[model samples]
Target: MAVQIKICGIREDRALEAVIEAKADFGGFIFHQSSPRNLTISEASRLTALAEDRIQRVGLMVNPNDDFLCELAAHASLDAVQLQGSESPERVGQIRELLGVRAWKAIAVASREDILRAEAYADTADFILFDAKTPPGALPGGMGLRFDWNLLKGLDVGLPWGLAGGLNADNVAEAIRLTRTPLVDVCSGTEAAPGIKDVDKIAAFCKAAREA
Candidate 1:
């Protein structure tokens, strides 16, 4: 099967249009306050509306509360909600049930044990995203750090999963060839600056993933 792609931390119309035009499978909206790409619910809703029927809209949250999730679900028509915090498997299940949307858990991979830990969410989450763990006091992701892809060689986590962290047009093909990840995700790799999505880079990344 062909590799699927997700362009994350999308905050504007041009970037989202680039994602759709590039035929990426998913477009992510960051809801966390610390990230430069964070978006208000209304902004995300508008972008989600524009992307309806064109691309899968995913909302990213970091240890969000029930009320926040409820508010987002009521307004944005998201295809999935990605939890990038320390949410437990049961909490993941509850959030999935409460939002009535696909649930994704992002695992920060610094070692083989981190990858194995993803199995814990296999039954609860609809998808697992393996991203490089950032340093202390930094954002959870989108910091452009990548772990050794060799760790994923010949691995299986019993559920659909994707690779993220530090992927760009230049290295995406190599990343895919090594990990054979069914899906690939990019964030700062396609940016002109923090939170600034570059259309040309987005196009090139998608082209590279497709050709791989």
Candidate 2:
């Protein structure tokens, strides 16, 4: 079966067009200021207002509170929220309740214990994101780093899950083959620079993911 693809950290018109044209399953917009890919509420809506009808629109944030979450929901048109910090399952439930929308929790995975930890959110979070654990003091994610795929082998993840971190056209197929991830998310892997999304790369990544 073809794996679902989520092209993340999209901030430009060309990138948005590439994702929509490529028929990606999801497209993500960053709301955290620490990353270069971060976008304001108006900016995210400007880039994705039309895309909301074409594909799933996700808002990516890091450890935001209820007020911050409410502000984004009121200003931006998003189908889901991806929380990428050390948020508890209770917090994930709060986000879902506050927004009345699907909320995903991103876990930094480096070991089997991390996978077990993710289960805590199974009942609360709408989805689970297993991403690479970034080094200390670095941006939360989108750093082009990958964890050992073997750690996830034969593991029973009890909820809807996706893989993120260091996925590109050249290696996404392998990642899919190894993890059998239903959904694969990419950010820096499809970019030309820190935050610049290359349209060609986006197209190729989608084609690779679909054919995988």
Candidate 3:
């Protein structure tokens, strides 16, 4: 199957248009307050509405509360919610049930144990995202750092999963070849600066993943 692609951190019409033109499978909106890519509920709703029927929309949040999730759900049209913090399996399950949308858990992988830990979310999360673990006091993800792809070789977590962290046009094909990840996500990799996406880079990354 052709590798699916998700271009994350979209905050502008041009970026959203580029992702749609590139035909990426998903576009992500960051809802974390500290991140450069963070979006307001209003902003996310507008973007998500613009992307309706064109690309799947996902909201990325970090240890969000039930009230905030409910607020976001009332405003934006999201296909899934990506949990990028220390949410337990029960929390994940509750979020999935409460939102009535697919839930994705992002696992920060630096060692074999981290990858194995994904199995804990099999019953709750609809998808698992394997991303490189950032350093202490650093942002949770989108740091343009990558772990050893060999760690994912022959991985089977009994749930749909994707690969993320530091993927770009040049290395995406090789990343796919090594891990055979069905879906690949890019954030800073296709950016001109933090929270600024480059249209050409987005197109190139999509091409590389599809051709892989």
Candidate 4:
């Protein structure tokens, strides 16, 4: 089976079109205020409306409050919510129950131990996103930083998980081969500049992911 592709941090219509044209499975909207790729709920709603049924719309957030999450779900028509903060397993469960959307819990991975820790959220989350571990004073995720893929070797978490961070056309195939991840998430990797997505790069990343 072909690996699912999620082109993340999409801000422009052209980038959205590129993902659609490439037949990507998921589109991500960053709702965190800190990130350069951050999108207001209204903005994400407009973009999500355009992609209605064409792809799954994923809303990315840090440890958001209830009101923020409610507003996001109401406005964006999100198919899934990715919690990329220091949210605990119970909080993930609460988000799942109250939000009524699939939960994609993101865990930063630096080693096999990190991957093992992800299992704790597997029961509550619909999917687990493995992002590169960031040092202090860095962005939450999608910093285009890569981790050791060999660290994931022989790992078997029962839930569906995605490989993310520093994934692009050139190295996506290798990442896929190394981890055999069911889904791949690309953000800065497909961008021409920081938070500026390149249409061609998006297309290329999607194609490579599918072919892998």
Candidate 5:
């Protein structure tokens, strides 16, 4: 099967339009205020309403509380929640128990050890999103940095996993070929500027990922 394509960091109606036109599998909304791609609940709600069943709406949060997650889920019209923070496995369980929504936990991987961390969350999360570990004080994600894909070779866990960070149209095929990741996600890879997604780049990334 072809790789599942996800175009993340969508902040506008046009960006959402671009992802849909490109047949992306998932469209991400950053709920963290620290990131430039961050979207308010009102803004995300407007865009979420425009989302169809063809694409999954993923709400991205960083170290969020129960109340915030509840409000975000209610407003964003999300199909899944991506926990991109330091949330513990117990917290992950709590989020799932409380909201009862599909949950994806992002694990920053810089080495094989990082990939092994998926074990703790495998049963708790519906999916595991593997992203590059950024420098201290850097952005939470969408930093366009990459780690070693070979580290994921022969790796197996209970939950499904997706690849992210520094992946563009050109290298996504190689990354997929190396890891054979079932799902691939891109943000800076498809953007001309931070928080500004280019339509052509979006199309190119999707096409390349599909071809890969």
Candidate 6:
């Protein structure tokens, strides 16, 4: 199967164009206020509309309440939601029920035990996203830090899963080669600066993912 690619933190027209041109499987929109890449629902709606039927549109939120998720669905045309914070498995189920969209839980991996902990989400989340753990005072994700790819070798996961954290065109092939992740997510790794996505990086990253 071709490796699915989720190009995250995308907020501009050129980035969206690159995502489509590179044949990415998913185009992500951030809704977390704390993140530089965050987009208001109205802003996301416009971009999400561009991705309609072309690629799966994913909305990213961090520890959001029900009302926030409700607003997201009401404003944005999304196919999936990525709960990239400390949300529980039950909450993922609740969000899926609330939005009628596929729900993905972001599991922060710093150790094997963290991977073991993510199993609890398998029953609720439509997919599990393995992202690098953030620093104590840092935002939830998009820090550009990478975990040990070897830590994922032979991981059971017990659910459909994807790899994230510190992935760029240069190292994405190594990541996919090592973990064989069916899907891969990238954000800062494809950026010219925080919140600024580089079209060339986006193109190269997608090219590497598909070739890998």
- Candidate 4, clashing residue pairs? none
What TM-score does structure 3 among the candidates reach? 0.99
For model 1, the stretches where C-alpha displacement exceeds 4 angstroms are none
TM-score of 1: 0.99
lDDT by residue (tens digit), candidate 1, 67-102: 998898888899999999899999999999999999
Please state the error at residue 20 of candidate 2 in Å. 0.8
lDDT (C-alpha, whole model) for all candidates: 0.95, 0.89, 0.95, 0.89, 0.89, 0.91
Query: What are the candidates' C-alpha RMSDs?
Result: 0.6, 1.0, 0.6, 0.9, 1.0, 0.9
What is candidate 5's lDDT per residue for 1-212, written digit by digit as tens?
88999899998888899899999999998988889999988998898889957589888888889788778767668888889999888888788777777889999989898899999997688999999999999877999999899988997978899999899989999999999999999999999899999999999999999998
**Candidate 6 stretches greater than 4 Å from native:** none
Backbone N/Cα/C clashes per model: 0, 0, 0, 0, 0, 0
Worst 10-residue lDDT window, candidate 2: 44-53
Q: Give the TM-score of candidate 5.
A: 0.97
- lDDT (0-100) at residue 148 of candidate 1? 99
Give the range where candidate 4 is weakest over 10 consecutive residues by summed lDDT: 69-78
TM-scores for every predicted model:
0.99, 0.97, 0.99, 0.97, 0.97, 0.98
- Candidate 2 C-alpha lDDT tens digits along 61-117: 888987877777777788889999998898889888988889999999888898778
What lDDT does model 3 reach? 0.95
